[model samples]
Target chain A: AQSVAQPEDQVNVAEGNPLTVKCTYSVSGNPYLFWYVQYPNRGLQFLLKYITGDNLVKGSYGFEAEFNKSQTSFHLKKPSALVSDSALYFCAVRFRPGYSSASKIIFGSGTRLSIRP
Target chain B: EPEVTQTPSHQVTQMGQEVILRCVPISNHLYFYWYRQILGQKVEFLVSFYNNEISEKSEIFDDQFSVERPDGSNFTLKIRSTKLEDSAMYFCASTPPGHSTNNEQFFGPGTRLTVL
Candidate 1:
Protein backbone atom coordinates (compact mmCIF):
# COMPACT_ATOMS: atom_id res chain seq x y z
CA ALA A 1 0.00 0.00 0.00
CA GLN A 2 1.04 3.57 -0.71
CA SER A 3 0.21 6.69 1.31
CA VAL A 4 0.99 10.41 1.31
CA ALA A 5 1.02 12.77 4.23
CA GLN A 6 0.79 16.56 4.17
CA PRO A 7 2.04 17.83 7.50
CA GLU A 8 0.39 21.20 7.21
CA ASP A 9 -3.34 21.69 7.12
CA GLN A 10 -2.88 25.31 6.00
CA VAL A 11 -0.03 27.56 5.01
CA ASN A 12 -0.16 31.36 4.80
CA VAL A 13 2.29 33.57 2.99
CA ALA A 14 2.57 37.20 2.00
CA GLU A 15 2.66 38.38 -1.55
CA GLY A 16 6.15 38.39 -3.07
CA ASN A 17 7.38 36.02 -0.38
CA PRO A 18 8.50 32.49 -1.04
CA LEU A 19 6.15 29.69 -0.07
CA THR A 20 6.50 26.01 0.58
CA VAL A 21 3.89 23.27 1.00
CA LYS A 22 5.29 20.16 2.59
CA CYS A 23 4.56 16.59 1.48
CA THR A 24 5.88 13.16 2.46
CA TYR A 25 5.14 9.67 1.25
CA SER A 26 5.60 5.98 1.98
CA VAL A 27 5.66 3.50 -0.88
CA SER A 28 6.89 0.00 -1.41
CA GLY A 29 9.01 0.80 -4.45
CA ASN A 30 10.01 3.68 -6.70
CA PRO A 31 7.50 6.51 -6.35
CA TYR A 32 5.82 8.65 -8.98
CA LEU A 33 4.94 11.91 -7.27
CA PHE A 34 2.65 14.72 -8.38
CA TRP A 35 1.27 18.06 -7.27
CA TYR A 36 -2.16 19.48 -8.08
CA VAL A 37 -4.07 22.63 -7.23
CA GLN A 38 -7.79 23.14 -6.87
CA TYR A 39 -9.85 26.28 -6.45
CA PRO A 40 -13.12 26.32 -4.61
CA ASN A 41 -15.77 24.23 -6.36
CA ARG A 42 -13.36 23.33 -9.15
CA GLY A 43 -11.63 20.17 -10.21
CA LEU A 44 -7.96 19.62 -9.47
CA GLN A 45 -5.44 21.06 -11.95
CA PHE A 46 -2.09 19.40 -12.47
CA LEU A 47 0.84 21.49 -11.35
CA LEU A 48 3.88 19.20 -11.68
CA LYS A 49 5.25 15.72 -11.33
CA TYR A 50 8.48 13.95 -10.31
CA ILE A 51 9.31 10.82 -12.29
CA THR A 52 13.01 9.93 -12.37
CA GLY A 53 15.14 12.72 -13.76
CA ASP A 54 16.45 15.71 -11.87
CA ASN A 55 15.66 15.96 -8.19
CA LEU A 56 14.11 19.37 -8.79
CA VAL A 57 11.04 19.30 -11.08
CA LYS A 58 9.43 22.45 -12.49
CA GLY A 59 5.72 22.67 -13.11
CA SER A 60 2.96 24.99 -14.34
CA TYR A 61 2.12 28.40 -12.86
CA GLY A 62 5.63 29.02 -11.65
CA PHE A 63 5.65 26.12 -9.22
CA GLU A 64 8.36 23.58 -8.53
CA ALA A 65 9.13 20.70 -6.18
CA GLU A 66 12.18 18.92 -4.86
CA PHE A 67 12.20 15.15 -4.54
CA ASN A 68 14.36 14.03 -1.63
CA LYS A 69 14.69 10.28 -1.51
CA SER A 70 16.25 10.26 1.94
CA GLN A 71 13.50 12.42 3.40
CA THR A 72 10.77 10.72 1.41
CA SER A 73 9.46 14.22 0.73
CA PHE A 74 8.39 16.27 -2.30
CA HIS A 75 7.65 19.76 -1.13
CA LEU A 76 6.06 22.29 -3.48
CA LYS A 77 7.87 25.60 -3.71
CA LYS A 78 7.45 28.99 -5.37
CA PRO A 79 9.96 31.81 -5.58
CA SER A 80 7.24 34.36 -4.90
CA ALA A 81 3.60 34.13 -3.96
CA LEU A 82 0.57 35.97 -5.31
CA VAL A 83 -2.97 36.36 -4.03
CA SER A 84 -4.23 34.42 -7.01
CA ASP A 85 -2.08 31.48 -5.95
CA SER A 86 -4.30 30.88 -2.96
CA ALA A 87 -5.85 27.45 -3.36
CA LEU A 88 -5.85 23.90 -2.05
CA TYR A 89 -2.79 21.91 -3.01
CA PHE A 90 -2.51 18.15 -2.97
CA CYS A 91 0.39 15.70 -3.19
CA ALA A 92 -0.09 12.27 -4.68
CA VAL A 93 2.01 9.13 -4.97
CA ARG A 94 1.83 6.04 -7.16
CA PHE A 95 4.13 3.07 -6.95
CA ARG A 96 5.85 2.25 -10.24
CA PRO A 97 7.66 -1.04 -9.97
CA GLY A 98 7.91 -3.70 -12.66
CA TYR A 99 4.82 -2.35 -14.47
CA SER A 100 2.27 -3.86 -12.14
CA SER A 101 -1.32 -3.28 -13.22
CA ALA A 102 -2.84 -3.37 -9.73
CA SER A 103 -0.99 -0.31 -8.53
CA LYS A 104 -3.24 2.66 -7.68
CA ILE A 105 -2.51 6.28 -6.99
CA ILE A 106 -3.00 7.75 -3.54
CA PHE A 107 -3.45 11.40 -2.56
CA GLY A 108 -2.67 13.38 0.55
CA SER A 109 -5.25 15.10 2.70
CA GLY A 110 -4.43 18.43 0.95
CA THR A 111 -2.97 21.68 2.22
CA ARG A 112 -4.77 24.98 1.93
CA LEU A 113 -2.50 27.74 0.62
CA SER A 114 -3.48 31.28 1.50
CA ILE A 115 -1.57 34.23 0.12
CA ARG A 116 -2.00 37.62 1.74
CA PRO A 117 -1.85 40.77 -0.32
CA GLU B 1 -5.91 24.22 -25.73
CA PRO B 2 -7.94 21.02 -25.70
CA GLU B 3 -9.36 19.71 -22.40
CA VAL B 4 -11.83 17.28 -20.92
CA THR B 5 -15.48 18.37 -20.66
CA GLN B 6 -18.33 17.15 -18.44
CA THR B 7 -22.07 17.72 -18.66
CA PRO B 8 -24.73 18.53 -16.05
CA SER B 9 -22.60 20.70 -13.81
CA HIS B 10 -24.96 19.82 -11.01
CA GLN B 11 -27.52 17.05 -10.53
CA VAL B 12 -30.12 16.49 -7.82
CA THR B 13 -31.48 12.99 -7.37
CA GLN B 14 -33.68 11.29 -4.85
CA MET B 15 -32.61 8.33 -2.78
CA GLY B 16 -32.82 4.94 -4.52
CA GLN B 17 -32.90 6.67 -7.92
CA GLU B 18 -30.36 5.98 -10.60
CA VAL B 19 -28.17 8.69 -12.08
CA ILE B 20 -25.62 8.96 -14.83
CA LEU B 21 -22.73 11.42 -15.07
CA ARG B 22 -21.38 12.16 -18.50
CA CYS B 23 -17.97 13.23 -19.74
CA VAL B 24 -16.26 13.90 -23.06
CA PRO B 25 -12.51 13.46 -22.92
CA ILE B 26 -9.93 14.93 -25.22
CA SER B 27 -10.17 13.52 -28.76
CA ASN B 28 -6.85 11.69 -28.65
CA HIS B 29 -6.91 10.46 -25.05
CA LEU B 30 -6.88 6.68 -24.63
CA TYR B 31 -7.45 6.34 -20.89
CA PHE B 32 -10.49 7.62 -18.99
CA TYR B 33 -11.00 7.76 -15.22
CA TRP B 34 -13.72 8.59 -12.72
CA TYR B 35 -13.01 10.02 -9.28
CA ARG B 36 -15.18 11.31 -6.46
CA GLN B 37 -14.59 13.62 -3.53
CA ILE B 38 -16.88 13.92 -0.57
CA LEU B 39 -17.00 17.21 1.28
CA GLY B 40 -13.84 17.62 3.34
CA GLN B 41 -12.50 14.27 2.15
CA LYS B 42 -9.73 13.19 -0.17
CA VAL B 43 -10.38 12.45 -3.82
CA GLU B 44 -10.94 8.72 -4.31
CA PHE B 45 -10.51 6.86 -7.56
CA LEU B 46 -13.64 5.05 -8.63
CA VAL B 47 -12.53 3.41 -11.82
CA SER B 48 -10.18 3.58 -14.80
CA PHE B 49 -11.10 2.62 -18.37
CA TYR B 50 -8.87 1.79 -21.29
CA ASN B 51 -9.39 0.15 -24.68
CA ASN B 52 -13.15 0.46 -24.21
CA GLU B 53 -12.99 -1.80 -21.13
CA ILE B 54 -12.38 -1.32 -17.43
CA SER B 55 -8.70 -1.69 -16.73
CA GLU B 56 -8.94 -1.02 -13.00
CA LYS B 57 -11.48 -0.25 -10.33
CA SER B 58 -11.42 0.42 -6.61
CA GLU B 59 -13.39 -1.20 -3.82
CA ILE B 60 -15.71 1.77 -3.86
CA PHE B 61 -16.71 0.74 -7.38
CA ASP B 62 -19.05 -2.02 -6.39
CA ASP B 63 -21.98 -3.60 -8.23
CA GLN B 64 -23.92 -0.33 -7.99
CA PHE B 65 -21.34 1.45 -10.12
CA SER B 66 -20.61 1.00 -13.81
CA VAL B 67 -18.72 2.83 -16.55
CA GLU B 68 -19.18 2.90 -20.32
CA ARG B 69 -17.71 4.58 -23.34
CA PRO B 70 -20.83 4.17 -25.38
CA ASP B 71 -19.62 6.44 -28.17
CA GLY B 72 -16.34 7.42 -29.68
CA SER B 73 -15.71 10.36 -27.38
CA ASN B 74 -18.11 10.21 -24.48
CA PHE B 75 -17.50 8.37 -21.19
CA THR B 76 -20.21 7.77 -18.65
CA LEU B 77 -20.50 6.57 -15.03
CA LYS B 78 -23.77 5.13 -13.76
CA ILE B 79 -24.81 4.60 -10.16
CA ARG B 80 -27.75 2.29 -9.68
CA SER B 81 -28.92 3.79 -6.40
CA THR B 82 -28.27 7.13 -4.78
CA LYS B 83 -27.54 7.56 -1.08
CA LEU B 84 -27.02 10.61 1.03
CA GLU B 85 -23.38 9.67 1.34
CA ASP B 86 -23.16 9.64 -2.43
CA SER B 87 -23.57 13.42 -2.57
CA ALA B 88 -20.23 14.72 -3.68
CA MET B 89 -18.24 16.15 -6.55
CA TYR B 90 -17.57 13.61 -9.29
CA PHE B 91 -14.69 14.28 -11.65
CA CYS B 92 -13.83 12.82 -15.04
CA ALA B 93 -10.26 12.63 -16.24
CA SER B 94 -8.29 11.44 -19.26
CA THR B 95 -4.70 10.75 -20.23
CA PRO B 96 -3.01 10.04 -23.54
CA PRO B 97 -1.36 6.69 -24.02
CA GLY B 98 2.37 5.84 -24.21
CA HIS B 99 3.52 8.33 -21.61
CA SER B 100 4.98 6.32 -18.78
CA THR B 101 6.79 9.24 -17.26
CA ASN B 102 4.52 11.32 -15.03
CA ASN B 103 1.35 9.88 -16.57
CA GLU B 104 -0.45 13.13 -16.07
CA GLN B 105 -4.23 12.90 -16.10
CA PHE B 106 -6.22 15.94 -17.15
CA PHE B 107 -9.41 16.49 -15.19
CA GLY B 108 -12.75 18.06 -16.10
CA PRO B 109 -14.57 20.78 -14.18
CA GLY B 110 -16.54 18.10 -12.34
CA THR B 111 -20.24 17.56 -11.63
CA ARG B 112 -21.66 18.16 -8.18
CA LEU B 113 -24.17 15.48 -7.30
CA THR B 114 -26.68 16.18 -4.55
CA VAL B 115 -28.70 13.27 -3.28
CA LEU B 116 -31.88 14.05 -1.45
Candidate 2:
Protein backbone atom coordinates (compact mmCIF):
# COMPACT_ATOMS: atom_id res chain seq x y z
CA ALA A 1 0.00 0.00 0.00
CA GLN A 2 1.05 3.63 -0.61
CA SER A 3 0.41 6.54 1.68
CA VAL A 4 1.40 10.16 2.36
CA ALA A 5 1.77 12.13 5.57
CA GLN A 6 1.69 15.87 6.11
CA PRO A 7 3.15 16.33 9.55
CA GLU A 8 1.84 19.82 10.12
CA ASP A 9 -1.78 20.63 10.63
CA GLN A 10 -1.12 24.30 9.92
CA VAL A 11 1.79 26.56 9.13
CA ASN A 12 2.03 30.30 9.64
CA VAL A 13 4.57 32.46 7.89
CA ALA A 14 5.06 36.18 7.39
CA GLU A 15 4.43 37.55 3.94
CA GLY A 16 7.66 37.75 1.91
CA ASN A 17 9.29 35.05 4.06
CA PRO A 18 10.09 31.61 2.75
CA LEU A 19 7.57 28.89 3.47
CA THR A 20 7.91 25.15 3.49
CA VAL A 21 5.12 22.62 3.99
CA LYS A 22 6.48 19.23 4.90
CA CYS A 23 5.37 15.96 3.27
CA THR A 24 6.64 12.39 3.49
CA TYR A 25 5.45 9.12 1.95
CA SER A 26 5.47 5.38 2.24
CA VAL A 27 5.40 3.37 -0.98
CA SER A 28 6.63 0.00 -2.11
CA GLY A 29 7.98 1.17 -5.44
CA ASN A 30 9.31 4.46 -6.73
CA PRO A 31 7.02 7.18 -5.47
CA TYR A 32 5.13 9.61 -7.66
CA LEU A 33 4.60 12.77 -5.69
CA PHE A 34 2.37 15.79 -6.21
CA TRP A 35 1.29 18.99 -4.50
CA TYR A 36 -2.10 20.67 -4.79
CA VAL A 37 -3.58 23.83 -3.33
CA GLN A 38 -7.20 24.52 -2.45
CA TYR A 39 -8.86 27.77 -1.53
CA PRO A 40 -12.21 28.36 0.12
CA ASN A 41 -15.09 26.70 -1.74
CA ARG A 42 -12.88 25.73 -4.66
CA GLY A 43 -11.56 22.50 -6.09
CA LEU A 44 -8.04 21.20 -5.70
CA GLN A 45 -5.57 23.01 -7.94
CA PHE A 46 -2.49 21.29 -9.28
CA LEU A 47 0.74 22.83 -8.03
CA LEU A 48 3.63 20.61 -9.08
CA LYS A 49 4.68 16.99 -9.35
CA TYR A 50 7.73 14.79 -9.04
CA ILE A 51 7.55 11.94 -11.50
CA THR A 52 11.12 11.31 -12.65
CA GLY A 53 13.40 14.23 -13.18
CA ASP A 54 15.51 16.75 -11.34
CA ASN A 55 15.02 16.74 -7.59
CA LEU A 56 13.25 20.11 -7.68
CA VAL A 57 9.97 20.74 -9.52
CA LYS A 58 8.40 24.18 -9.94
CA GLY A 59 4.67 24.70 -10.19
CA SER A 60 1.95 27.29 -10.63
CA TYR A 61 1.85 30.48 -8.55
CA GLY A 62 5.62 30.49 -8.04
CA PHE A 63 5.48 27.42 -5.83
CA GLU A 64 7.94 24.54 -5.96
CA ALA A 65 8.59 21.18 -4.33
CA GLU A 66 11.72 19.11 -3.91
CA PHE A 67 11.58 15.32 -4.15
CA ASN A 68 14.07 13.80 -1.75
CA LYS A 69 14.08 10.08 -2.39
CA SER A 70 16.40 9.25 0.45
CA GLN A 71 14.19 11.00 2.95
CA THR A 72 10.98 9.76 1.33
CA SER A 73 9.79 13.32 1.24
CA PHE A 74 8.44 15.92 -1.20
CA HIS A 75 8.35 19.28 0.51
CA LEU A 76 6.51 22.24 -1.04
CA LYS A 77 8.34 25.55 -0.95
CA LYS A 78 7.98 29.19 -1.90
CA PRO A 79 10.81 31.68 -1.45
CA SER A 80 8.52 34.62 -0.80
CA ALA A 81 5.13 33.87 0.62
CA LEU A 82 2.19 35.92 -0.52
CA VAL A 83 -1.08 36.42 1.31
CA SER A 84 -2.75 35.01 -1.77
CA ASP A 85 -0.80 31.81 -1.31
CA SER A 86 -2.61 30.99 1.87
CA ALA A 87 -4.63 27.84 1.34
CA LEU A 88 -4.92 24.16 2.18
CA TYR A 89 -2.03 22.18 0.76
CA PHE A 90 -2.23 18.48 -0.03
CA CYS A 91 0.46 15.96 -0.75
CA ALA A 92 -0.47 13.09 -3.05
CA VAL A 93 1.24 9.93 -4.26
CA ARG A 94 0.42 8.19 -7.50
CA PHE A 95 -0.76 4.62 -7.54
CA ARG A 96 0.52 2.09 -9.99
CA PRO A 97 -1.17 2.76 -13.34
CA GLY A 98 -1.68 -0.99 -13.90
CA TYR A 99 -2.51 -0.09 -17.51
CA SER A 100 -5.22 2.30 -16.36
CA SER A 101 -5.57 5.78 -14.95
CA ALA A 102 -8.15 4.72 -12.39
CA SER A 103 -7.15 5.03 -8.72
CA LYS A 104 -4.60 7.49 -9.96
CA ILE A 105 -3.58 9.16 -6.68
CA ILE A 106 -4.06 9.22 -2.94
CA PHE A 107 -3.88 12.44 -0.97
CA GLY A 108 -2.43 13.37 2.40
CA SER A 109 -4.44 14.70 5.32
CA GLY A 110 -3.64 18.28 4.20
CA THR A 111 -1.85 21.23 5.81
CA ARG A 112 -3.41 24.62 6.17
CA LEU A 113 -1.04 27.48 5.34
CA SER A 114 -1.59 31.04 6.46
CA ILE A 115 0.43 34.03 5.36
CA ARG A 116 0.65 36.78 7.95
CA PRO A 117 0.99 40.38 6.92
CA GLU B 1 -6.42 26.32 -21.80
CA PRO B 2 -9.80 24.61 -21.62
CA GLU B 3 -10.80 23.48 -18.13
CA VAL B 4 -13.07 20.86 -16.57
CA THR B 5 -16.48 22.03 -15.35
CA GLN B 6 -19.28 20.78 -13.05
CA THR B 7 -22.94 21.69 -12.78
CA PRO B 8 -25.12 22.80 -9.84
CA SER B 9 -22.48 24.50 -7.71
CA HIS B 10 -24.69 23.61 -4.77
CA GLN B 11 -27.33 20.90 -4.41
CA VAL B 12 -29.53 20.30 -1.41
CA THR B 13 -31.65 17.17 -1.30
CA GLN B 14 -33.63 15.16 1.24
CA MET B 15 -32.26 11.91 2.49
CA GLY B 16 -33.10 8.84 0.35
CA GLN B 17 -33.57 10.97 -2.73
CA GLU B 18 -31.51 10.28 -5.83
CA VAL B 19 -29.17 12.92 -7.20
CA ILE B 20 -26.80 13.13 -10.09
CA LEU B 21 -23.77 15.42 -10.30
CA ARG B 22 -22.56 16.30 -13.76
CA CYS B 23 -19.14 17.06 -15.24
CA VAL B 24 -17.72 18.18 -18.55
CA PRO B 25 -14.12 17.14 -18.90
CA ILE B 26 -11.58 18.95 -20.98
CA SER B 27 -12.11 18.18 -24.65
CA ASN B 28 -8.84 16.34 -25.10
CA HIS B 29 -8.58 14.40 -21.85
CA LEU B 30 -8.92 10.62 -21.88
CA TYR B 31 -9.43 9.92 -18.16
CA PHE B 32 -12.16 11.25 -15.88
CA TYR B 33 -12.54 10.98 -12.09
CA TRP B 34 -14.83 11.84 -9.18
CA TYR B 35 -13.71 12.65 -5.63
CA ARG B 36 -15.49 13.76 -2.50
CA GLN B 37 -14.46 15.66 0.61
CA ILE B 38 -16.52 15.70 3.73
CA LEU B 39 -16.62 18.92 5.75
CA GLY B 40 -13.26 19.51 7.40
CA GLN B 41 -11.97 16.19 6.12
CA LYS B 42 -9.45 14.97 3.60
CA VAL B 43 -10.42 14.62 -0.02
CA GLU B 44 -11.27 11.04 -0.94
CA PHE B 45 -11.30 9.39 -4.33
CA LEU B 46 -14.62 7.90 -5.36
CA VAL B 47 -14.14 6.46 -8.83
CA SER B 48 -12.49 6.87 -12.22
CA PHE B 49 -13.94 6.42 -15.72
CA TYR B 50 -12.34 5.77 -19.06
CA ASN B 51 -13.29 4.27 -22.43
CA ASN B 52 -16.91 4.45 -21.26
CA GLU B 53 -16.19 2.04 -18.43
CA ILE B 54 -15.19 2.20 -14.77
CA SER B 55 -11.49 1.71 -14.37
CA GLU B 56 -11.20 2.01 -10.58
CA LYS B 57 -13.11 2.84 -7.43
CA SER B 58 -12.38 3.33 -3.79
CA GLU B 59 -14.04 1.35 -1.02
CA ILE B 60 -16.29 4.30 -0.26
CA PHE B 61 -17.99 3.79 -3.61
CA ASP B 62 -20.65 1.25 -2.73
CA ASP B 63 -23.76 -0.11 -4.45
CA GLN B 64 -25.49 3.25 -4.03
CA PHE B 65 -23.02 4.97 -6.34
CA SER B 66 -22.74 4.76 -10.11
CA VAL B 67 -20.91 6.64 -12.87
CA GLU B 68 -21.75 7.06 -16.54
CA ARG B 69 -20.47 8.84 -19.59
CA PRO B 70 -23.84 9.36 -21.20
CA ASP B 71 -22.44 11.64 -23.90
CA GLY B 72 -19.12 12.45 -25.47
CA SER B 73 -18.76 15.57 -23.35
CA ASN B 74 -20.67 14.81 -20.17
CA PHE B 75 -19.84 12.43 -17.30
CA THR B 76 -22.15 11.95 -14.40
CA LEU B 77 -22.12 10.43 -10.91
CA LYS B 78 -25.41 9.15 -9.52
CA ILE B 79 -26.14 8.43 -5.90
CA ARG B 80 -29.22 6.28 -5.61
CA SER B 81 -29.96 7.03 -1.96
CA THR B 82 -28.45 9.92 -0.15
CA LYS B 83 -27.28 9.82 3.46
CA LEU B 84 -26.51 12.61 5.84
CA GLU B 85 -22.88 11.59 5.75
CA ASP B 86 -22.95 12.04 2.00
CA SER B 87 -23.25 15.80 2.31
CA ALA B 88 -19.96 17.18 1.09
CA MET B 89 -18.16 18.89 -1.75
CA TYR B 90 -17.85 16.65 -4.80
CA PHE B 91 -15.10 17.34 -7.29
CA CYS B 92 -14.70 16.24 -10.92
CA ALA B 93 -11.32 15.88 -12.57
CA SER B 94 -9.85 14.88 -15.95
CA THR B 95 -6.44 13.89 -17.26
CA PRO B 96 -4.84 13.54 -20.66
CA PRO B 97 -3.12 10.42 -22.00
CA GLY B 98 0.28 9.01 -20.94
CA HIS B 99 -0.01 8.39 -17.24
CA SER B 100 2.29 9.65 -14.49
CA THR B 101 2.21 12.14 -11.66
CA ASN B 102 3.33 14.72 -14.18
CA ASN B 103 0.15 14.18 -16.19
CA GLU B 104 -1.73 16.61 -13.98
CA GLN B 105 -5.49 16.61 -13.76
CA PHE B 106 -7.73 19.56 -14.46
CA PHE B 107 -10.40 19.93 -11.79
CA GLY B 108 -13.75 21.64 -11.82
CA PRO B 109 -14.84 24.16 -9.22
CA GLY B 110 -16.94 21.35 -7.62
CA THR B 111 -20.52 20.77 -6.50
CA ARG B 112 -21.47 21.15 -2.88
CA LEU B 113 -24.09 18.51 -2.03
CA THR B 114 -25.98 18.97 1.20
CA VAL B 115 -28.07 15.96 2.20
CA LEU B 116 -30.58 16.46 4.93
Judged by DockQ, which candidate is best?
2
- What is candidate 2's CA lDDT for residue A114? 100
**In model 1, which regions exceed 4 Å deviation?**
A96-104
The TM-score leader among the candidates is: 2
Candidate 2 lDDT tens digits, B1-116 = 78899999999999999999999999988888999999898889898888889888889999999999987999999999999999999999998877634588778999999999
Candidate 1's DockQ: 0.52
lDDT of candidate 1 over B16-43, digit per residue (tens):
9999999999999887889999988888
Q: What's the true lDDT of residue B4 in model 1?
A: 92
Q: On a 0 to 100 scale, what is the lDDT of residue B51 in model 2?
A: 84
Worst 10 residues of 1 chain A by lDDT: A95-104
- The lDDT per prediction is 0.89, 0.91
- What is the alpha-carbon lDDT of model 2 when measured against the actual structure? 0.91
Proportion of native contacts found in each model?
0.40, 0.64
DockQ, every prediction = 0.52, 0.67
